[model samples]
Every structure is written in structure tokens, then in C-alpha cells.
Target: MNFSEVNIGLFRLVNDLGKEHEQLNIIFTFLAEYMVFLLAISVICIWFTRNKESRIMIFCATITFTCAFILGKVSGVFHSNYQPFVELSDVNKLIVKEKDNSFPSDHTILFFSYCFSFWLFKRGWWIFWILLALLVGISRIWVGVHYPFDVIAGMILSFAVAINVYIIVPRLNGTKKILNVYEKYEGKLFQPFRKTKGSKTRNY
Candidate 1:
């Protein structure tokens, strides 16, 4: 069989599980839909920490995601497919999605771009981010919104961008300068709330 046949068969394997086990459908549905908001909140919280390392990590992640997103769009121009539910029979579609190009799943691109950047920057306890990315990719397939090839293509594209961003961004003098300028303004903005020695209450 050709690649498209294999892609559909793999999608069927994952999507069919939702029909057999109702409980997993709920989990995968959440991962497919709402987990992105959680990831966004986490990134914002990390940025507010004002720690240089965390800020740099966030910068690298942002750049990685931007580049990957552009690449995904470009790839869509060349190759595009509707969602699996739109193309195949007996799809276990769990979420509401409009009919559009589903090649190189956008969710997969987004999660892997940021999560893999997190893994590269903080290797210890942050490894869960990689697992989270993988689950999100699978969840897209399990929800019947994407084919296996869509998710796989996204993973490969984001991983390549993430690795390059991690290597190049940190070494750039402009990255450091931008961080320093932002931190300078940030410190002033929050200065009134900072506690002073021998003062029980903050100035603000």
C-alpha cells in the first residue's frame, strides 16, 4: 500500500480507541482542546518570574514557534488535506472543527515547538514537556481531527526549528541586550511594590 493508505490505517488505530473506551475520549478531548490554554498560562507565568534564564527560555520558545508556524503554513500551500473525519468513514471525531487544511497539524506544531524548547533549556524536571507534546500530537489523532502523517510532519518540522533556535538565539548579543532593556523597565514598573529594609508594608 501507498503512504496515504498507511496514514489512514494508523489514524484508525488511534481514533477507534475512543469508541471502545469512553473514559479515554474525555482525556484525549481535553488534551486536544483545552490543554493549549494551560500551556499558554504556564508560559506567561514563567515570563513574569523575571529570572534571566527563564526569560531566555521563553524567548527561544517564542522564536521557535514563530518559525515553525510559518513553515507549517508554507507546507500547507504545497500539500493540504481535510480532517480525517471529513475524508474517512466511522471517524470518532470528538471536537468541533471547521473543514480546512489538516496537513501538518497546527496543534502538534505549537506544542512541540514550545515543549521541546523547554526540554532543551531545562533538561531536569522539565522533560515532562516533551511527553506532553507527544500526548498532544496523539490526542489530535485520537480525536480524529488529524491523520498520522499530519502529526508526524508537524513534529519533525517543529523539532528542527526548536533545535536551531536553542543553539543560535542564546549566543546572539541582541538577545542579551533586549532582555537587559526589558528587565530595566520591568524593575522600575514594579519598584513601588518592592519591600524596603525595616518596612513591613510595601511602598505601594
Candidate 2:
């Protein structure tokens, strides 16, 4: 009826994969976390490839990521703690016991945030990231920390944030200053949009 039910069914599907090997399990978790950073970085790079709209979404990611990290550190003390390690047997019943908090999932936030970035940039390219994003979401439950609901919440939150940034932000036109800067470098790399637009490329 609700999101958790769907997550329960979803997580159950891959419950078998958790049985493979300890090494593989760790690999899944590691990859999930790593992929978030990779996609986040890619979003930042996209600023120059497209236009003002593109860069705005990525800039939101940079800000969101920083906010998440800072909040985790602050929240980690009371609502959460340092999870140094996890054992194999505890994989099931991950949500009720081991993981912290139900409202927001850092992994979900991180995963969906990146997913939104790529999806906006190129739908085809976005598909690959989406698959990787789901895999990463499952890995959290597979390793025993996040519930399906937690991931869903995170993903939903991330999706909303990205959408708001990409769509609503532009409506404000307050982003014009930054968009102008990005538009200037529509075809270059590692350079600010402003500088690229200002440079002379050929003889007049």
C-alpha cells in the first residue's frame, strides 16, 4: 500500500545476493558509496557542456552534498553513530535494528541526487546511472543499514531537490548571473563559462 511495502518486496528479491560472499557484499556497499561521488563529480563537469540550466542543477548538488556531510557529522553524534563494521548474519532485518534514522537516508540522498544529475544531462546516459543508482540503493539494505523506505525517502527527496533546482530555480531568474557565466563556456572544459566566452578563438 505504501513505500515500505514496495521496498520490502524489492529488498526481498535480492536477499539471495547477500548470501554470496563477504567480499562481494563489501564490494556492493563500497561501489554504492563510490558511485554517488562519481556521479556528483560528473554533474559538476556538465556545467560547461550545456547551458545555464545544466550548471544550475550541478551547483545545487555541490551545495546539497556539503549540507548532507555537515548534517551527518552533527547528527551522527546523537541520532547516529560511527558504524565501524557490520557482520554477515545481521543483513536481514536491517532497518529495524542496525541502521539509524528513518526519515532521511544519506545513501539515498547521495544516490538519487547523482541519478537526477545524469538523468537531466542525457537520458541515455542517465539510464546507466539509474541502474547503478538502484544497485547502490539495494546494497544498503543488502549490507543491513537502510530500509527500503529509507532509500525511497532519500531518493524521493533527492528527486524533488534536483527537480526544484533545475526547474523552479530557473523561473526565479535569480540564477541568471551564474547561468550567464556557464553559457559563456558552452564547448570548453576545465574552464569557467565566463572566461571561455570572452576568449578569442579566430581572426576576425
Candidate 3:
């Protein structure tokens, strides 16, 4: 049918899937909630490394996250789409109800924006980050708080923001200056945590 009908249909399909098993519900909910923490930890680890590539990555991610957040907030002002649980009669909402705009899922936008920004640079392990981002988006729909279209829009906007940030950040002279400063001081700041070369760990 039309786009709204399609949205409802997909929402029903995945929302029902969540109701089929308690384990799936728990798994999806956990993924939606905690996957961002994993991404944050990754950013922190990358920040500590302080190499050129890591510097560029963290910079792009920082811009992407900021743009995504601003766009998400602005989207709510223009289009306030209600949650599926709010509009539909029977929704298996595994997560807590949210009354905010659902047109573009904020969680999806933030995580996917970060993951996609990194993937634009590094081509290997970032693939897992992309998949994790997809899983997080799907989990939002599965939990019945977001319509499929909401998640899809979030992904589309996130990719757009990430690509723009990736392209634009490297061209700025200030980026190089800040990165130089960060690299210069990173070793001193983390000296206590730095491991010696050729150090061996004892096995218990």
C-alpha cells in the first residue's frame, strides 16, 4: 500500500517477533541499550592511542555525533511522529515508553552515525561496527518504540551527516593543529598506563 501502511506492516512483523520469545526480547533490549556504551568505549580506546588515523577518526566521529544530535532535535520540531505503541492498539513494547518524536530514532542516528563515520575511513574491523549499528536500529523497531520508517530515516540522515563530516574535517587546518597537540601530550598523560616494550604477562 502506501508508506504509512508499509510502516505499520513492518512494525507489526518485527514487534510480533519480539513477543515470540522472552530471550529475544531481552537480547534485543540489551543490544539497543548497551551497544552505545561499546561504541563509547571504542572511542575512548581510540582517543588514548593518539595516532594520526585515530585522531582523524575521533574527530570525524565527534562531528558526526554532534550533527546527528542537532539534526535529530531539529527533526522533532518539524515532524513529531508518534511512537508505534502510542498509535497502535497492540504493540509488544519491551522498552520504556517514550513520548518524544519518533520520526528519526535518536539512538539509531547517534550509533549509526559514529559507526558509519569510522567505516568511511577504516575498512576492516569497522564492518562489525556497521553490523552492530544495524542491529541497534532493528532492535529499536523490535522493541516497538520506533516504526520501521523512523529507524530508516535515522540511518539515512546519519549516513549523510557522517559522510559530510568525514569529508570536511580533514580539510580544516585546526584539525591538524589540535591533533599535533593531542599526540604530543598523550604519552605523558597515559605514561602510567603505558606498557613496556616486550613485557610478558604471567599466566595463572
Best by lDDT: 1
Can you rank all candidates by TM-score, best first?
Answer: 1, 3, 2
Estimate, for each residue in 1-204, the C-alpha lDDT of model 3 and write its tens digit: 998899999999888997787678888998877888888888888776646787688888888888888888888788777899889988998878757678889888888888897799884388898889999999998888999888988898889989898888889999999888867787677665555432434321
TM-score of each model, in listed order? 0.93, 0.60, 0.87
Q: lDDT rank, highest first?
A: 1, 3, 2
Cα lDDT of model 2 by residue, 1-204, tens digit: 775466556655565566765557667767655666776567656754665545665666655555554554454455432221232343443223453344456776776776676576554377887888888877776756665665666676677667655565546655677667655554355456646555755322
Q: List the residue pairs that clash in candidate 3.
A: none
RMSD per model, one decimal: 2.2, 6.8, 3.7
Worst 10 residues of 2 by lDDT: 81-90
Off by over 4 Å in 1: 195-204
lDDT for model 2? 0.60
Using TM-score as the measure, name the better of candidate 1 and candidate 2.
1
The superposed Cα distance between candidate 2 and the true structure at residue 201, in angstroms, equals 13
**lDDT to native, each model:** 0.91, 0.60, 0.84
Task: After the best TM-score superposition of candidate 3, give how far the Cα of residue 136 lies from its true spot, in angstroms.
Answer: 0.4
